[model samples]
Target: MSTVNTTPHTPGPLLRMSDIRKEFPGVRALDRVSLDVAHGSVHALMGENGAGKSTLMKVLSGVHPAGSYTGSVEVDGEPRAFADVAAAERAGIAIIHQELALIPQLSISENVLLGHEETRYGVIDWGATHSRARELLLRIGLDENPALPVSALSIGAQQLVEIAKALAKNVRLLVLDEPTSALNETESERLLELLLDLRDQGVACVLISHKLGEVMRVSDEITILRDGRTVETLTVERDAEGRPSVEEDRVIRGMVGRDLDQRYPEGEGTIGPVRFEVRDWTVDHPTQVGRRVVDGADLDIRTGEVVGLAGLMGAGRTEFAMNLFGRSYGRYVRGSLSRDGEELRVGDVADAIAAGVAYVPEDRKSLGLVLDDDIRHNTTMAALGRISTRGVIDPGLETVEARWMSEHMRVRSHGVDQTVRTLSGGNQQKVVLGKWMFTRPELLILDEPTRGIDVGAKYEIYLIVRRLAAEGACVLLISSELPELLGMCDRVYAMCEGRITGEVAGADADQETLMRLMTRTGEKK
Candidate 1:
């Protein structure tokens, strides 16, 4: 399955940006950046965070008004200036942001037809709006009722809703920003198919994302940006002459301007006695606590081993971890939870942490970090009392510790005083790592540890995991990518429909075997 839109290449340019230069107070966001998009083809713009990609996309979509920067944007060989996003929209450029912009209180149809509402003079034309939304939804393979409130849909569905909204405006150049970050594999596949279909309809697309595999699969051309400058743009084709094909080295060389000998640094670790265990652990479905979502899952982690949990979406991996961590899920959980070879009660988060267990949840916004709070506050969340004295938070002490974490973790930010929401997803993930690292637990659980982080930062996190393992901390990682689990874990527990179906030695495991076990026959998931 591919996540890219494909097309027959024509010898004509659809969109072009020449000598683009923009500056912030302390950062030159883009310098002499030039790019071209062919008609009916997907052009992927790639770079590490703070590499001027976001700035370029904003400029292209007219979020940065004309005359604010020195740049020339031309479409179809004609010079045009976009004064605002509305002007760009009128020019058939529609952008979808990573964080969706639909209103929760509004229906899908309402959100889709928000600014361009169908109206007759002073009267709102609800009938026409609903009809148009229905048509767009059908085109995007969404059969869900368009009248349903957007809040009730999953993140993936809401993303499709965003696409449907964009489709309503008759866009020619569609800019998608990390569109698949929150989607499951199947949902992502479906979305990619939709993009391909759109390209067939003669719509050009510019995808700004960190996922290189997907970028290689769908894009005809890929451009790399680093430190606010345009690097080489690689053309991808089965018959391309004298160039790298689907290998990561060429892309890495362009993105970082350096060769990484090793993506993940290795460290020696000695396995000690079992530190955590769950016996006959079953989670009654969260909605129905007595019904099992995870049934009789038995797994163990040693003192210095990294164990990976791998499965498809809705396979109960996250649910099992949540139930194991703090009994946070399931109305009725019946199981034996143990730590350090001794029975431990984890009725709440406090009890779990007190017993030397820490979990970094997958959904950073809902379960991991508090977005409204600052970095210092989030880092001190799991173990606030340790940094506090006499029940009052010592602000100076907290800052010192947080500062150390920021430096060690290489969190890219001016200071811990900055709001966590303002930071990128990768940085927010680092803050989550700092929170768990500060807890100083024996067993640390990381779910989708490198979900949206760039290549450079992913290597850093991999090294961090290696360091933690070397220091005798048992880490549990849940990830959708099989290669990550195979590369990082010492052992792996494969799950399918709330059961620990298979186990493999990390050294002996392959993606095919793990997937077969995960997709077991006769399992009603």
Candidate 2:
């Protein structure tokens, strides 16, 4: 018998998606999209708002079943079609969405073992559940007790619990969608480290994030998608000098399909007289008696000036802003607020709006926009009077104003009739800004405005902020990113332990200086 030459078999990619095309009525959301993730490696998906990143992930996760979209998902070189989320989980694939799904009232063990609880005779075995939950928690570096309610934990801890839930399902291919969008700097770093550890343990990871810095730091390979199509997949490349690096400009060009020379829009404007002033602002905890959250904060902003509030997580920035706006949060709020040299009492939300103050909250989905409502309604919700006759809304006028806002904000959508929940995070943020702009406020307070948005969208928002300031609006911007504050604000106030520690001119501000002042407590101007 003649011995035939046999070639050695090579394993295929751990997961491969090819020729994905999804369509809705009058919209082709994804066009021939494709992806390949290697085993034990981190794959990053990059895209702008409404660029079909989430839609593609949904397809992979079986939120849209096999028949709903045209694509081929192969694992271990074998074609697999998932019928639903359960089917996907059966295939060792798990996805953690941006908005957490844990029930606040449930304990950590209960949430982790939900739907997959250990049972004896169809009765849930509480001891077994707690034991497994504890093991999973310890495996993920979470030291908290599993019996504690999820509500008692911080947002960062909640995210770790979410990961533990994924691990509980024995997930081999894990997808994290904007995992750190709501986390502070330290929390985000810790989360990224956990992902890296998971990767080293032979688990594949798919990370979807808008924070370019984090993406660059963690991704082994990056695939940029634009206009619902894959532009290019880039790997870490080295120059002739043999130093490993990836140029941010190269990634930006792939994401936007062009060169973006500037990351922030020009904020050149004339600063006029003081438009708003707050003196001795102090606020006690809403439920805790005699506990102060904001203490003796004195600040002032001029017309057409962008002021930045800088602090670490739990530095009491959000508490101060919420307490100042209509006293919507906290009790025993003692503050003197003035506009144009006239003292105003913001006793309620209605009074705050009437006094020319508008706030765009940080948690836009839950706190800012009505997700289930249509864009037209959300756009004009704040200033219904502008589009209403008497107390009744004029449908035609509402449509006109909504259309105007949609065009002005460049909101990418099927139409104004589309529900806000269906829009991307960036577009939803635009809707919130439009709603507040219609209020015609002389002072605008934006909290963590660009928290989860892409770089391109951030640039657009920066332009809008500058435009508002040029129109003589005093803009108070609160953000955790020091670069954002340095780039956009004319002046920055540092907060530490619920008090204003110090203030720095934007031109003279740096990260080290701001951090020093931010940690300096009990120092007041």
**For each candidate, how many residue pairs have backbone atoms clashing (under 3 Å)?**
1, 0
lDDT of each: 0.84, 0.89
**Candidate 1, lDDT over the whole model:** 0.84
Instruction: Please list the residue runs of candidate 1 whose C-alpha ends up more than 4 Å from where it truly belongs after superposition.
Output: 1-12, 23-25, 66-70, 77-83, 151-154, 239-246, 521-525
Candidate 2 lDDT score relative to the true structure: 0.89
The residue-by-residue lDDT of candidate 2 on 397-462, one tens digit each, is: 999889999999989988899999988889899999999998998999999998898878888899
Model 1 TM: 0.91
Q: Which stretches of candidate 2 lie over 4 Å from their true place?
A: 1-10, 237-244
TM-score to true structure, per model: 0.91, 0.95
lDDT of 1 by residue, 1-525 (tens): 112333344366888899999986555779999999999888899887778887888898889989888989987777878999988988778899887899999999999989887898877898888887888888888888878999999888899899888877877889999999989888888878888788877888898878877787778789899978999888887545534365777888788778888776765889888888889888878675356678888889988899999888878898888878888766535888787768998888889899888898888877898899999999998898978898999999999999999888889887888888867777888899999999898888998988877887788888888889889998999999898888888999888888888899998999998998898733532
Model 1: number of backbone collisions: 1
